[model samples]
Target: MRPRHPRDVLVGYDGSDNARLALQEAIFIAQTSNARMTVVSVVPDVAATINAVWLAGGDPAQLSREMRIEVAATLEEAIEQIPEDVPVTKVLGQGHAGPVLVEQIDRIGCDLVVVGTRGRGAMRALLLGSVTEYLVRHSSVPVVVVPPPERLRDDLA
Candidate 1:
């Protein structure tokens, strides 16, 4: 049985395979709990950097527009994967994935947040970074970290 307090399950989706697994898990949790599910995608703003580069060379506006379109398409594809019977909502926002996801959790008053972890170790996490780690450290709500699929493990092996 699902907890009563956590009537909402919020998930962060970025079109990654891991994120797709998280979405499936989130749907299961929401179904079992009879809770609402929300899928969120954060589109980082590249305007300033693009503009600066554009001033030097290339078309910033075109690039930015193309990026936005790509993001939207990705989100749409992710949404299509969600189960039709499950009650779900899609949220698209701007900013870094971690902060934006945390903010959305608070804004939506979600009791739990679900994310997929690519299993980055300490050194890699420190150098390359991890969004799951950021959310775990900063989120006000409970966060569930779903590991990559077994197929991924096989591939790695």
Candidate 2:
């Protein structure tokens, strides 16, 4: 069950267009409700990262370190976009998006969780899974999922 008024809000951000939209919505909610806000960016686990780098013809060990650095920079940039009036905390999570976010929600004791849909569609999401789909099923608190803009939605379709 969701609280009538949330005291803490957590948003999953990945520096994507849809994530930016979700961040905006989270900012608005936090401002209006006077709730503390947290933004988190999750990187794939070490094994997953290594596999991806190896498959992409990169140095598995060295590239994973570089990838983490890049992701941290991007997460910091996303944090900067939040307005000064809205107090926010930034977190970098390691592991899959859904579980990492759920863990953050638990750690922060957030009352609401916000994330953007990847727009992978039902079939693809079922096959490969998506963070949004996982949260909808697993999150303990209420979740708000922001979809891509209409123009982008057309492209996704």
Candidate 3:
């Protein structure tokens, strides 16, 4: 069976292995389907009071700048993997992960969205919630959830 082609595809990237796989899949789909791709990374915003409390001695401005730099690097790595023939755009967003992704989906008018899920980290979940789950439930467009690589899967026999 053939999968439907997406006109404009949006992928959420975080520089994780799962995200790398998702980017690879999205690129292949974009290439075969003659679709354009957009890659987005989120730089979560911590409130000033929270930063002062949790960050302690860390400089807020420096931390924000570093986050932007990391986001740019992630985009650059994804861009390098993409074939030259495929049309692609990159965006670095600020704020919470789920809402930012949802906002980008609407703002970009993408027909499809791709995201990657990570291992269950209780601390991470308690802090950031689940972006993948939120997108699967709330996104107006279709979504593809890419799991960890085969080598990383412990269930395979």
Best by TM-score: 2
Least accurate 10 contiguous residues by lDDT in model 2: 120-129
- Candidate 1's displacement at residue 71, Å, is 1.2
Q: Please give the RMSD of candidate 1 to the true structure.
A: 3.2
Ranking by lDDT: 2, 3, 1
Model 3, 103-136: lDDT tens per residue?
A: 9889988999988776544444322228888998
Candidate 1 collision pairs: none
Best by lDDT: 2
Model 2: per-residue Cα lDDT over 1-157, one tens digit each:
9648788889988888888889999988999998889999877778876788789898987876876888898789878988888778889988888999999989989999988876565456433227888898899999998877676665455
Q: Using lDDT as the measure, name the better of candidate 1 and candidate 2.
A: 2
Output the better candidate (1/2) by TM-score: 2
Report the Cα RMSD per candidate. Answer: 3.2, 3.1, 3.9
TM-score ranking from best candidate downward: 2, 3, 1
